[model samples]
Target: MSDNWVVQNLQDILNRWNSTLSDIWTLITMSPENFQGGAIWRIVLNIHGALQAIGYSLLVLFFLVGVVKTCGTFVEMKRPEQVFRIFIRFAIAKGVITYGMELMLALLSIVQGVISTIMNSAGFGTPQDTVLPQEIIDAVEDCGFVESIPLWAITMIGGLLVTVLCFIMIFSVYGRFFRLYMYTAIAPIPLSSFAGSPTQSVGISFLKSYAAVCLEGAIIVLACVIFSVFASSPPTVNPDAAAATMVWNYIAELAFNMLILVGTVKMADRVVKEMMGL
Candidate 1:
């Protein structure tokens, strides 16, 4: 078979793989929505309402605990400053419980804004193309069918690996949205801890953890942007190598780079947590 025919066949496989990655990218870069037309998001918002209702009942209990802990005796409670502080704490905590969903959404919005800014600055308006090098194409074309059998096998394996990695990366991003929904749903419970001075640490820790989850997207985006930069410069093919050797070498490095991107996305939460000391 002619080299042109061989190159075109392999090129078609590469094109399909690239197209799949591009489709997955649509899911990755977009922000999640709670008030959207989606049933899942709406259900999640309803769950948040239910949790917030329960949090309201707990709010009174938490405030009472704070009052008892802070006030030594009835005489202490008579002090103007003591009375003012407890009242202010109760009021603020009540407000938080009442507006827990809004607060969580606001937090998500802020983090998404950060992601947008990073994407804009990085100039990543679309998914990065993961194209194989022309050298690899040329090398594959020079091989006879008998020799090209292994090349086809290598390409098939590489294509499958790339597609799997694309799904894995996109799913990691989707997982972040689910985490956001969960955090929003249960926000009131943790936030109500703020009503008690002794338990305020619980609420503070919850806020920190939630922020870490939200910032995870930023880390994932950064990883993808870095990968794009690396991928822009294809691996240098050895001109003297056999066709199978060149194809193997190229696929191996490409898979490794893809693995790095997938791993980064998977570890995004941990990365953000460590960065934020959460």
Candidate 2:
């Protein structure tokens, strides 16, 4: 044959994997748009606005509750430190109310900057391509029709596995996007608790959890980069083995590496939580 059929099959698998990985990268680094024409983002923005409207009312209630909890007598409210602390709390809470969207966006920006820095430092402008070895090509081309039958079966199965892993990896990144939208939409309610000294802990925890979610992107990107390095150095294939055995070995190792990447991407949230002690 003019072209090794195994090599041609591997190329198609490589293309699909590359396309999915590119989508993952795009999801990680690009800034999300809230005001864009897309209905999903706009709906998220509208929900955020609605929650913020409700947040103002909740802020007043939280502040009053804080006053009651902190002050046994009106005299305590008159003390310089107590009065100043309450004032500071209200001011911070008000700031959050007015700037919640900007604050959420800022957190996303910082995490994305970290992702960009990591990718740049690694000298990876794009996800690394996992190519089949030249020896595999040579070996497969030497196989007779009967031997190539099993080789073709192995290749087909490997291609399916790779395609599935690629989609799994991409979908994991999409889940992150959904979380981002969720956080933005509901930020005001948790943030409003800052108006009350007693309830400030709720706001603090919310911010920490949100920040942790944002940082998951960074962790996920790092995982992909590490996996790319592993992909670049695939397990050595023994050319002396029967063609089908050699193909199966290569496919098995490739799938294993892709599985590792997919697993890491799925665990991105847990990894971030452990790193941040959240």
Q: What TM-score quantifies how close candidate 1 is to the native fold?
A: 0.90
> Once superposed on the true structure, which residue ranges of model 2 sit more than 4 Å away at CA?
1-4, 34-39
lDDT of each: 0.78, 0.85
Highest TM-score: which candidate? Answer: 2
TM-scores, each model vs. reference? 0.90, 0.93
Candidate 2 residue-wise lDDT, 13-125, digit = tens: 87788788887887788766832336778888899998898999999999999999988999998899999988898888989988999988888888888999999999899
Off by over 4 Å in 1: 1-25, 34-37
**CA lDDT for candidate 2:** 0.85
